[model samples]
Structures are given as C-alpha cells and as structure tokens.
Target: MATCCFLSSSILRHPSHTTPLQGRLQTRRNFSFFKITAIFWGPKKTTTPTTRSMMDVSLGTFTLIGSPEQKPPVEPKELQQVSISVVSSISNVSSIDWDACAVDANGQGIFNPFLSHAFLSCLEESGCAVQETGWLPQHIIAQDENKNTIGVVPLYLKSHSYGEYVFDHSWADAYYRFGYQYYPKLQSCVPFTPVTGQRILVRDAWYKDQVIDMLISALKDLALKLQVSSLHVTFPTETECQRMKKDGFLQRTGMQYHWKNRNYKNFDDFLMDIKQSKRKNIRQERKKISAQNLTMKRLRGYEIKDKHWDSFYRFYRNTTDSKWGQRYLTRDFFHNMGSKMGDNVLLIVAEEDDKLIAGALNLIGGDTLFGRLWGCLPQAYYPSLHFEACYYQAIEAAIELNLSKVEAGAQGEHKVQRGYMPVATYSCHYIVDEQFRNIISDFLVHETKQMEVVMKMMQDSGPFKDGLE
Candidate 1:
C-alpha cells in the first residue's frame, strides 16, 4: 500500500499585509500523500528531525523541529510523499534526469538552454561557478516514491552577489549595518544570467504541484538549518513569481530590452517597421563595417574552433578588465561550453585582414536568441562595431533562424532606440528576519509601480513606428 503524509501546516500570508513578527501566529494547511524523507548534512545535523507535532511557523513558513528520540512523523493520507536531497554539484545527478525536470517542468515543451544540465555542468567543470569563486553549488533534488526525478532547483550558497544580475547590494549593506553577515545567503538562479525562466524545475507529473510546494518548504528548512541570511530566486517566470508570492516571498520587478520579431521576411522588412531615422541610422552603422573592410561571420556548432574561443576569451577579459569588472568566467568555460553545447552556441566574429578583432557570444534557445557577452581587441575601435556585432547581427540571425526575439542582456536604454523595447523581469526574495522582510516588501511595492511606469515610457519611446506600441 502507498504511504500518506501530512507535509506541514504554516500560515501563508501575503508579504505586504503581514503583521510584525512579534504580533501574529496563524497557520495554513495543505495536504500531500507522499512519504517525505529529508537527508541532513554535516557530522551532527542541525536541522530538526521529522516528527508528528505541528512545527513552529517562522515568518509565515514551517520551521523544522524535533529530536532523534521523537517518534517518526505520521503520514497524512492526503499528502503525496517526496524525498529531497542536496548535492554539492550538478554532476551528482544524471543529465537526462535533470534535463527532464527542466524542459518538461510546465508540461509545455519549454526549453531553456541556460538551465540545461550541459550548460550548468560546464559552469562547474570550467570552474566559473565553484566554491572558490563563492558560488558553491547546493542544488536541491526531489524524487517520487518510484525513485523518479520529479523536480530540481538550481541553488547555490553564495558568498557574495556579484554575477546575479538582480541587484541586492543594498540588502547586503543593510545587513552589514545591522551587524549581520549576508555573504553566505542561498540563491537560485543561472549565475551571471538574467533571462527569466522557471527556477523550480518540476516535471509535468501528477505530483508536480506537490513537489513544488515541497521544494519551497525544503528550501526554507535548509536555510534555517544552515542559518543563512535569506534565499533568493532570481529571474523566474511571472507565473512562478505569483506562486512564490503566495508562499511569502517578496516579489520584485525589473526591466530588460528585448527585440520581438513580427514575422519579417528579412532584415529590410524588420527595418521598415522602425522609424525612418532609426532605419537610416542602422543602415549607416552597417556601412561602417564594410567601409572598415571588416567581414562578419556567424559560426555555429563545429564551425567554431578552439582558436576562436581563445580570441573571444581575450576580448572578454579585456572588456571586463577595462570596466574593472571581475573576470568571473575562466578561459576553460568558453571551450567547455563550445564542446558541450556547440549546436546551441552562436559566436559572431568580426574579421579584418584575416585576423579576428572582436566577437559576441550568444546561446540559441527554443525560440529566442540570448545575447550574453561581447568584447573587442584593445584599441581596435571600428565605427559602430559594438552596435553591429551585438545588436544588428543578432537581429539578423534571429530573422534567419526564425527565432522569436533577441533578449539582449540587462540595463541598456540605448537598445530602445534600436528597436529593442523594455520588458519586465522578475525575482522573489525570502528574508529570514521578519522586520527586514517587511522593510523589503514595502520597498518592492514602490519599486514595482515605478518599474511599470518606466516600462510604459520606454514602449512609447521605442524605435518602432507609432502604431506598433
């Protein structure tokens, strides 16, 4: 016979309306029938063991509590049983299983290459995201009774928030002011990536909802056990944001520039949609490349070579060093990504006199082209080269591949004048301390409204001809 279990009962309140931590005690109940088993880390586990009694509610979530001597918790009939474990690396799980959870999470064939096992593993294998760099992998995996992978969450115990595009330095500063350490907080995101997608990877099983709920519960429990300052899930889908909000996470909104393709036949058709000035400006920029005697090539799969990776890495280092930005990605990362995900990798290179001078890196998605990194050789300034390599070329590639849009990376208002319009990106935060949670919640409320206004303003000012808005 199958086992039934009661997950946990805790008050689920909207973050904004909740009372101060000292004043309220409320409980909300959800039912599951899966046997929930949790594995503890360290010599002596700090997390509370499973038990039958109602767990204490800590800031609107269940805080685990029990001694080994306590009787095993009763399995509530209505609850679905799940087993969750933490792996120090993504390599611990098979790629097929991990990819299954990632791509089939929503029952739709939603594919995000960034979240794929191959891409994430490359980050680890290349040493770009590792304990040494402060992105220690502490991924959460959920499984059903049959031992099938039901869900996974790409999580990390971050020592600092550098690569995550969602800015939280203010929160860190606030923590320091209060004499609290914030470096080792838990984060769920594609390191250095800001594109929105599902962070909680759950398969389209009958128990997907339960697994998601369980994963969130387990995340909170682990945070308490590890005693981290908070848990942040960045760049999750809008639907995921709403679900997380219901579970007490503070919702945040930000913007990115994206160029949407409206079934254009070619680059010329795309240009026609924009205003005459913008179209002429783009044509003029394209002319600069030809005037400089530069040749542009879009290399994919085996067409990209080791020499190209080396050149791109140099360009990347130069770009980052000039800006005083940390070189978070190592040389090996580029080679590894090319080897593992070559088909999905697109490298746009500008060649002059048979020598590569600059390059832009992008990863092809199911229907979107993600523009990630771009760099040029030192003192090799060609007129409008940056615009050509990064923006126009990407748009042309998208048109040729018939992809949906080009999600140029974060925070560039200039993209608006080039037909890329502002779109909202989301993140959700869970603050362990109640006071801080309320403070952040209030700030997000204001920030969200401001973001909405900015998005509308950007759309109005977009390069597209008037009726397009």
Candidate 2:
C-alpha cells in the first residue's frame, strides 16, 4: 500500500516511500478506519512461494500458493500450455522480452518508463528496492507454448507498505488488532513510484485478454499460497481496475492532480485558457526563478551528464530527507537510469552562476511527462524553486514535447491552482478471507464516494477557462 497524502515541505516530488501518517497515527475509543495506528514496517521475513497445489487451466497446470475454491473459467485454447512462475529478480528476464510486454500492454500508445526493464532493474541493481528495504521482488513471468515471454507483472513481497501511493495502513492495523499477520503481503506496483500504468502486462496478441485473466488468477492464487493477508494491485488503469473488480477483487478510487494538454502553440497560449487569477499566479511563480537569478534548463538523455546525475542525486536525497521524509531511491539509481533509459530521462536543473542548485527528475512517457523527484541544495531555500522546477518545467516540457499530460506526482491541492487538477486514480485489492474482504469492501464503497465528491469539486474548481475540459 502507498503511504498517506500529507505533502511535506518538499512538495512536487515522487510519491512513494514517504513518511506516512503512521508516525502520528491518532487514536480514540471506538475509532473508525482512519483512526488506527499504522504498522508500517517490521522485521523482514521470507515471502518465497511454495507449491501448495497445482491449478488446472487450459494453458497448463501451474503451481499456486493456495488452491482455488472453484476452477477458473476456461482459458482461450490459443494460450495452450502456458506456464507462470514467480521469479525473484528482474535480471532473470531479458530486457528485450520484458520491455516488449510493458510496451505492448498499454493498449493506448502511452508508455510508462517506470515499468520498463531498465527502471525496475536499476532499482534492484542499485540495491535500493531489495529484501532489506522491504521491497523483495517476486516478479511474475508467463510463457506460452512457443516459449515466448508474453506476460509479466512487477510484484513485490513487501514487509511494509511505505512507497506504494495507495494507503492500506488501516487495514494492516485492523489485521493487527484482530491478531492476524499483514506484513509480507503481495504488492503489485512500480517501486518508489506512484505514476499509474498497467500492472497486469500482456503482449498484444489474439489471447491477450485470456493471458490477462490468467495473470489475475495467478496473482490471487499466489497471495493465497503465500498466506499473506491480501494482495494489492496499486495504481492500475481504471479499465484494469474494472476487470479485476469483475473477477472478485475489491475496487478502490483515489485522486491525483494532472495537467492535461489542450491544443496550444506555446505555454503563454495555454495560459490564456485558465482563469485570469490562476494564470497571473502561475506567471508570477515563473518570474521568481528569474528574480532569484536561477536559470532553468531541461536536459534529456545524453544531454544529462555524470555531473548532473551526481548533483541530481543530492537534490533527490534533500527532498526525501525533509520533515517525515525517507530516502527510498539510492544515488546509484540515477546513474543507472541515466545510462539505461537514455532519452526517456528528463532532468530539469536550476543553475546559479553556472552552478547547479536544484533539480527535478522526470520521465518522458509515450504521451505524458512524469514528475517523479525534485530537490535543491538543502542549505539554501529559493523562492518558488520547487514549483518552477517540478510543475512549470514539467508543464512546459509536456507542451514542447507535444505530450498529452503532466502528472505532478502524488497529492497536492496547491497543484490544482497551478493547472494540475484532480484526476481519479485506481487500485484493486483481493483478500484471502471473505469476512475481512467484505469489511474492507464496505469501507472502499464509502471512500470511493468521497473521492467522487472531491474529484468533482476539484474539476469544477479547476484553473482552466470555463469552456475548457
């Protein structure tokens, strides 16, 4: 599960591995779901899957953590003799095959760089998201009869729910109060990243739908077999959320602010579409960068050198080390991603007297510019640097690149006024026990309605001109 929504001083940064509400979890007699103290982290235990039963499906017999109560519906005959296994490392799969699945799974043209082989592999290789960090990779890989790698999921046997943007601390606390184990649960997400994309990845094929169904079954069965309290597929596409809900998973909804691009020639042309007040405020914020004598530069791929990576890592750590912050990504991750992801990496840095003072890290998606991380020299505070580096630069980059939107990472009401209005985000959960499942499901029902109200309010209060979407 993701941490809480409380945005700290270092606003406009990546969303995961945050200082959750657990630190100050409030309590009162006979409290509700939001009251319980979060048991965020604990002793790291093994989540290695053991063969408990063999599931008989058209694809083939596959190992499972728990046996199904009923047989799965018929799989398409085209997916004959399919094999699914939980691998411990991303290195076990070739980037060529893994990336192919990640790219193809996006029925839309959007590509999530966080789901790419390079990104996940760098997390493991850099020693940031390993078992010691409570993010043990148990990625699933599926193969068809032809031995073609067709599907993959970036799953983790997590001991804590720190970095996931979907908060389930209350559920864990409930499990604790009821004398149940909750840690070592299965979490499907991009580590230290909250940008939503496809979690159940399948290559484009005639049996794509069947493969997706099978993968869903595999995840549920794996959760049961592992004997974890639940399985969480966080930040999936809304369509995937619906599909999972139809298959017995509990649906959930939350909101994040994202700036959508309307057809515009430039940043000024786009600003005219927003309300005059918000537009004036945005222009003033941009002006602060100049008043501070800071030059903002957007560097992509090879344009970002080792020196920039060095400084950017410091910037990222500065952001994470702020109040209630925890550094999730290691310094090496920056260098590794720089070498591996090439042009997909967007590093916007603030320079003063030719010295790098601050930076914001973003990934260029197929149709979006993702604002992931940001920071500056911790000792000095520049007015509006965070907003300029993370928000304005991202919006400018998205427009310049002709991308569809700019996802300014997690929660921030401030972003709405700056053009990143609320957009609904989704996740699905599967509880092994029916009773507990219903309890959480009931809570989700109420929570989803609240989200709908909040999203509508944000939409109605958007900075855009009345005629804009």
Worst 10-residue lDDT window, candidate 1: 22-31
TM-score of each: 0.83, 0.85
Model 1 Cα lDDT, one tens digit per residue, 215-287? 8888888777777879999999999999999988999887888999999889999999999998899899899
Over 1-469, each residue of candidate 2 has an lDDT whose tens digit, in order, gives 3323111111112323333343221111122333221222223232333322222222234432221222453445423566987778899889999999999997765578999999999999999888889888888888865778899999888888898877788687666645566787888999888888999889987667777888998888788777777889999999999999998999877777788998667899889998999889989988988998999999998999999999988877777788438888887988999999999999999999999999998999999999988788988899899899998888889988999999986666788888888777888999886756866776666566546655676788788887877
Candidate 1 deviant stretches above 4 angstroms: 1-80
Per-residue lDDT value at 463 in model 1: 86
By summed lDDT, the worst window of 10 consecutive residues in model 2 runs over: 4-13
Error of 1 at 293 (Å): 0.5
Please report the TM-score between candidate 1 and the true structure: 0.83
Cα shift from native, residue 314, model 1 (Å): 0.3
